[model samples]
Target: MGAAVGAIVIGASAGALDALSVILPALPEGFSLPVIVVVHIPPDKRSVLAELFQAKCRVPVREAEDKEPIVGGTVYFAPPDYHLLVEADKHLSLSSDEPVLFSRPSIDVLFESAADAYGPALIAIVLTGANHDGAKGMRAVVDAGGSGIVQSPEGAFATAMPEAAIAMCPTASVLSLSAIAAYLQEV
Candidate 1:
């Protein structure tokens, strides 16, 4: 009865990044779902994720600005050195608060905030990474009545992240990158 899908949040790590470039293009054009991405970038560096995705995805991609409104058909990246959060009204909030799991732009921060703001209307996808950053957050999504998905461990360049997510939540779907894009279209 609530929103079918208010947003999609993706958490990615170091490996399998090249494959993501391939997977992003397969998403439906002009999709109404807003996408928020949390990627591990070095603390002092600037993110090229927006620029990289801009060329590959049909949807507009930009770094999340403080207090920016969350909009559909757009992809917002968590800027390096800050944790990006979603507000109750579906706007963005950026914080330089203490890092979790040694990550500034933490996947858990975004996922937890999204769970609080959107509740049942969110979809969380955890991709390849060396750490277990997204596992707790994916569990938060499931607890908030949202869907939780992870890249299949066998398909990932780094299996730790997906494996952790699966360990935390059994119902989390393990999907290939292409399958994830397709499922997003259907969801």
Candidate 2:
């Protein structure tokens, strides 16, 4: 066994729901890392992502609340219109801050903050998306000595985000969606 991973952060955009359906259901109930997800979604609409994933995933899944503590064996989703941040104390904080790259709940915000909080204990993953939103964030994770994974562009529904991340963080592992799921299960 290796040192326990403290947290996992995932970012996705276009075609995210379908991708999540595959990955989320594969996570085992005993997973020991706090999993945080940021998927591009319409900010104005109420999100049911938590409810949907909870139904399929054996592990507990819910929308992240402001000031909540991050817990292992749980999956937390950034709310539609707020930036989700992780503190050094391992508590979550929500910010109504301006959107980044036109996304309110930017993947960069969550990934960067989690990387800062968890340092080498963090694992960051970038999935399919139309833009390069998560590229710099993944770089931050790697710079902080955290590991990074990017879905292979060929395996993504939208390749731009993964491609950008791979370009920016050349050492990051490039895995297919199924491979990523398997890796998570093993973790």
Candidate 3:
């Protein structure tokens, strides 16, 4: 039942709470893979996602800090208004780069960088969202020989993101939100 993956990356926008609430809590205690998340959010509003999820999750959950080393068995959500990236050495980095797909903390930036850093040892999951931000990132993961999973468009609260990812990488596994939670737990 081991997923040979070194790290996991997830991206979402609209309806992200429902998806994350399901997925994060199901990770068994001491699960070893590091999870990095990007959820489109307001540029000015404070992000409480880390605090919100930490209470509900078994694993350590926090906001990604610039230059921090990425740790296994933890979940990190990108801070609002910044792009989160994985350095080749596997350290977490923050960028004030221009937003992608009109969203700061763009999913594409995180996915693309993580794809390069972890390559075949990575898994990228695209969940519910309202835009196409994650499509290019999913393709990058696939091209880098990493695994890609997309939430089924039909079951997603906002289908555009999942549909776009599926269209971009037709070979990715398409599953329901609950199924996605189960899948992550098994990894």
Candidate 4:
């Protein structure tokens, strides 16, 4: 059998929505793994990313709620002002804890927690972003034997986050937006 991916965590900032619009729509309806995403948004603004993706993607999508059980074949996005975390038991949690690197729904928090919870079954994707929020978390995912995929800086609208992650995990697979979508289909 191919690698059994239990969960996929994606982190993005800056031009993330445009990137996600391209990526999310490409996942097939039968995708069986859970996808959790953290994209930087202004704390005061409402997030409709889940709804936006849900409309275009085949898989069901929703804003992650605190204490919800993590389920397969669904896409979950962190709420605007809270940090999303994955528990060891595969449950979702939300924290109003102080922002990390000025992002409330910090990508690092979700990626690190998911790495701890899913270990090698996890696949972490660091996409286009203007900041380094997901770099350390991508390293954590790699340390836990999970796969790390970074959007090639040439394709990213903002290169800092992907570049940082690639710097930390030099062996990570680098792909373009459409290639990432295709990779998810394979996973």
Q: Clash totals for all models, in order?
A: 0, 0, 0, 0
Which pairs of residues clash in candidate 2, taking residues 3 or more apart in a chain or in different chains?
none
Model 4 is weakest, by summed lDDT over 10 consecutive residues, at 1-10
Lowest-sum lDDT 10-residue window in model 3? 1-10
Off by over 4 Å in 2: 1-3
Model 2: per-residue Cα lDDT over 69-171, one tens digit each = 9989899999999999999899999999999999989999999998899988999999999999999999999999899999989979999999999999999
lDDT of 1 at 29: 86
Across residues 76-110, which tens digit of lDDT does each residue of candidate 1 receive?
99999999999999999999999999998999999
> Per-residue CA lDDT of candidate 3, range 41-154, in tens?
998989999999999999999999999999999999999999999999999999998888899999999999999999888999999999999899989998998999999988
Clashes of 1: 0
Model 2 TM-score relative to the real fold: 0.98
Candidates' C-alpha lDDT: 0.89, 0.93, 0.93, 0.93
Clashing residue pairs, candidate 4?
Answer: none
> What TM-score quantifies how close candidate 4 is to the native fold?
0.97
